[model samples]
Target: MGSRLRIVLGQLNLLVGDVPGNAAKIISNALRARDELKAHVVVFPELALTGYPPEDLLLRPDLTVRVELALGEMLREISGIDVIVGYPKRQYGKLFNAASLLRDGKVAATYFKHRLPNYGVFDEKRYFVEGTNPCVIDLQGVPTGITLCEDVWEQGPVEQAQNAGAKLMINLNASPFHKNKGKERFDVVARRARANGVPIVYLNLVGGQDELVFDGDSFVVDGRGEMTQRTPAFVEGLYLVEVDADGQVTPITGPIMPELSEEESVYTALVLGVRDYIGKNGFAGAVIGLSGGIDSALTLCLAVDAIGASRVEAVMMPSQYTAAMSLEDARFQATTLGVKYSFIPIDPMFESFLGALKEEFKGMEPDTTEENIQARIRGTLLMAISNKTRKMVLTTGNKSEMSVGYATLYGDMAGGFAAIKDVPKTLVYRLAEYRNKIKPVIPRRVFERPPSAELAPDQQDTDSLPPYSVLDPILERYVELDQSTDDIIAAGFDEAIVRRVLRMVERNEYKRRQAAPGVRITPRAFGRDRRYPITSGYGAETKNEPGGNGPAGGI
Candidate 1:
């Protein structure tokens, strides 16, 4: 009748559609927590069974059947301590996002999520039928409340639990990372705990799930509304905490520290994102094009840091126009990072494209079309290598290039994953500098040399676009800030440049849509968080015409 209850928060990274593998991982972590940490209970994040936001996969009955089978096996495998894990459950011909409370190899309690968030990359309502009841379970003689991700975000579930006479509320979540979202999470948990007069444990999933990267900044709040235990964001591990009858919780003495700054946090997030994406999918390794530019260098460093140097390969595809210093720096960086390096001269392919189009465009001057052709040829070679070696190709285009239509559609954008597709050009430089500060793997010329596509002879980025110092700030306001063209122009930028940049972004919709999924580090990312219609008329400075008129825009 007398027992001290210890709960382990399993902030694990689950692969989408990998039900059995995910179940095995959950059971292993639970055993470690129960045996090694001597914890009485373990709770994993929402949708840990089939992974978070299964997206269109939920429509598949076979996937659900597999999940159900996996859950049954997981229940049978789990022993000793109680377990609270999330999974998709179908009851009476309806699908529900439910969590099972397991003990002695049986489901003690099951709670379906009440609030189905449908906004901003979430379409839960469309897929799940809501559960209207509250679930309260007896944990070591004290009643504990249970809720899913969005359930605890609002006050209804928390209040219902408190009214149900529960002393502790545990929330399982798969919350995606966004700038300033960690603080917002703390605020919500503290407010809910203080208002409900009960201790709360907020657990989130970690690692990347396609375009979404869950930060896993799990924490525990006391009844008095103080955060007692906080797990690091963007990493995977078990965070153990002890909750008392008085509703006071404290972090277990171990090796978990708070994540540093937004940039550092995001950088680590990208590393974990890439690692999980490659590892979970069972890729032998990853291949990236080393353009001797900042974006590729940063991505190479991240890939090496994620899966080690031996697992990362860098290829230098230089055209006749490629700078000698750029090639030197590319070789230097490849050697410095100790990754597999190769050089494939793109001049032959470039000439082929030019010859193929020579009859059609004999009088027209060589332009970006020709440059894109060269890029496409390089892309073809990289993809061929990727197909031959079974290694995933990592595209190195930054958010800036992606934003302003600066990237080619099937050319540089052809890859299994775009490691930094959400990172801005300016941040690309910053991360490169930060990486160099550690071991100086990237050559000085990589940073010092002008950024270029090197498709045509002596082609600098500044030839067709503004400097990153200028372009990145404009893009921040337009993409992240969600400012309209007029708003951006009013934010202290040249109207002409804003208009041109906005036009480029609008015209590049088809390209961005075709690009691979990448790590999302900012408040708004390119893939999911930032959504725009391809057939639209709104853009940067077009709002204010000569008479100050244009089409209205919406986020």
Candidate 2:
């Protein structure tokens, strides 16, 4: 018997529904692991062949056909080393999330995933049937158990594997990232390893899929709940570990990646999410309407970092009321970033709209209607450029503005993707400063100046809403945490201000519904995470029953 067992963990970024392409990558990587690393067994993440959360694509008739063909291809091409691969299995007209152990060009054993995660971005119960049995196989002279993502979260699977005489365990995962998710995952995995009294290998998928970003912080833990090996976050690569004849696991000494601070992790996630979204959707490039404010400046920086400066275009559309400082800062940022810059004065377009509506608005006083016209003109110009260039417009509305309906509909809200839609206003300033620490790309004066829409004379964001320092926390509690108006007021916020902010958020569901899809960095984003009815009497209920604690009365 071999004295040591060599295992390779494939932490990969895979595209969804590309069965043949994914199959090719698996075959190539397996060969590299077998020949170069001499790995006795190579492990891949859950649903590696089909990609994570394949969503409604699994319901397609061709899915099973394509998956079968890909599995056949992998089996025919791979040999000389054992391969544990995750794929969807269609048996007896039912689908099960499964892992197959391939040895000598054939499947030696299989393990089906018992736990189906149904909350927060996972809907596995909609597609896969629950698996019941624990599978253990002998490698060299030791027994190894297999489990899928959610299986390890519960106690049964790990205990069952140990009861079945497995000396070691491997859990495959496609877990998504939110803030501090890495620490949470480690705690859970460590507890299970100690409880089961076996060293376990945890492999996770890494990439951006739509709104979800998976950070592949894969690692191995001994029976004592000690981490033997840890891979870095937000990248793709192969990690290795070894098991001795005594079944004691030792990690190959590589760089034990340092943990990123909260700001750093979030910024990296945004960049990765933007890159994958643009690349996966095949966008030619990105275009931003640079307002020279903190929001647009930060969004432009993210775009440059995501897909090079050459691929990003910055347009400064200064209306009559636009500040000189605004133009100066916008120009400086575009020049510093080396992106293509254009100056398009919206005066002509603004005057044209006012002229057309002059007679129709004879009886009405000048109001936000005129301000919205300025925004709509800018939106029209940006969209026209986007259409001509086949580039996506990256909208720069932050969560603070988006929450209280401070943004104009089809104006600042118009874009293909909203990079900072989930980012609150206070955090925007911090991120800008963080970027500057790496290299000062954003202008200092931009941060110094008070934020404005620059549509009307001497306008400021505080003219209509509360200051962001006060506003962001209130919004976080109300929108993200779903706290009641009474709860917010009781938390030391002014009662009137709390009521006003909550009312604004409640009234703006219609606008948010029509907005573009953005990268999600917060616990509760506007779209998938927080869903509210647009046309409802809930706001009235909140006003009438300010002290009530239920959803309708809460805020």
Candidate 3:
């Protein structure tokens, strides 16, 4: 038996449904792990061959064929090094999330995922049937068990593997990012390792997929439930671990990457999400409507960081009510970030729109309709620029406004992607501060001034909504925590304000449904994570009932 056994954890960023491309990457990484690292085995993240959560793409009839071809290609090309990779396997007319162990250019063992996660952004149960068996393989006299993502989250798989006489466990994952999610993962893995008395290697996928951003904080934990080795978050690399002939794993003596602060982690997630979405979809660049507000400032900073200053464009569309300070700050930000800047005053467009709508508004008094026209004009200009330049328009609405329907649907909400849609307004200011610490991009006055849509004369956001500091906590409880109106009131909030906020959130379902997808930094975000019906008759009218209000009110 060999006295030393080395393994490489390949934390890679894979594109969904790109079987050929993903296969080529896997083959290259496998060869590097074997020849370069001089390791015995290389382990890839969950569904590394097909990317993650391929969603409905797994149901395609040709998917099985493509995956098999890719697997066969890897098997034929890779030799000497054993490789463990994740993919979807179809057997007896049913699909399963399975991992393949290859040795000497042939499959040595296959392990199917036992637990199918169905809650929170996951719909695995919809596509895959549960796998009920344990797979243990022998490599250099060490008995190793294999498990996929959610399998280690439960007690059955690890216990089953331990009972099957496995001494070491390797768990593959494609876990998505949310606040403090890394700590949650570590807690679960440590408990499982100590409970089963087995050393565990936890490997995770990295990169962005639509609204999901996977932070590759992979690590190895010993039987004593201590983290021995850890890779940094939001990075892609090959990490190494060693074990002896007696099946004892060595503790990593090198530096364990420090955990990122809440603000830093969220900012990084937004950057990665923007980078991957634009890069993966083949956009020329990103165009942002740079209002001299905190939200747009933060969005601009994120875009510059994601794709560099060369690929980002900032447009300032001033209106009749536009303040000089706003214009100055917007230009300062543009100059500071080194992005292309353009100024197109919308006064003429606003006059033209009013000229066309004069007859239609003969007997009507002007209100939000006039303000909406300004926003819509800006939206139209941005979209036209996007169409001409093939650049994606990154919207700047934050979660606080998005929740209470403070956003205009066909106006300010018109864009290809929303960079901060899932970020709350309060967090937006923090992220701005975070970015400025790296370098001063956003002007200081932007944070000091009150937020506004600037559609009407002296218009401030407080005119229609509560202060963000007060509003954001209420929103976190109501939207993300799913607290009831009464529950929130019971928690020391004004009942009238709570009811009003809840009503607005309930009535604005249609708007949010039509909004662009953005990065998810919280536990619950709109789109895939939270599903609400657009047309519903629910209101926040309740008398101390638990499930009183319908979907909107309950949310």
Name the top TM-score candidate: 3
Per-residue lDDT of model 3, residues 325-363, tens digit only = 999999999998999999999999999999999999999
The deviation in Å at residue 494 for candidate 1 is 1.9
Candidates in order have lDDT scores of 0.83, 0.87, 0.90
Candidate 2 achieves a global lDDT of 0.87
- Write one digit per residue (lDDT tens) for candidate 1, span 1-555: 224578888989888888889989998998999999898899999999999889879989998889878878877888899999999999989999998899998899999999999877789987899998899998876689999988878879989877887778899998988667888888988988888778888899988877778989898887877888888877689877876554343323433466577667778778888988898788899999998878888999999999999988899998778888888888889998999999999888778777888899988986567777877888899999899998899999888888877787778888999999888888888887877777989888777778888776677889878898999999998888888888988989998888877777776776788889988778788767778887766653453444223211101
Clash counts for all predictions: 1, 0, 0
Tens-digit lDDT track for model 2 on 1-555?
Answer: 438888898999999999898889988999999999999989988999988879888999898999999988888999898999999998888999999999987889999899999866678999999989999988777788899988888989989998998888999999888788888888999999888778888899998888878889898888888887789898898777777745454333444677889888889888888888888889989999999899999999999999999899999999889999999999999999999999999999888888999999999998888898888888899999999998899999998988987888888888889988889999999999999999898899888888999888999988878899999999999987889888999999998888878877877788889888888887788887888899888868654644333221111
- Model 1 steric clash pairs: 485-540
Enumerate residue pairs that collide in model 2.
none
Each prediction's RMSD to truth: 3.7, 3.3, 3.1
lDDT of model number 3 = 0.90
Candidate 1: segments with Cα more than 4 A from true spot: 1-3, 246-256, 538-555
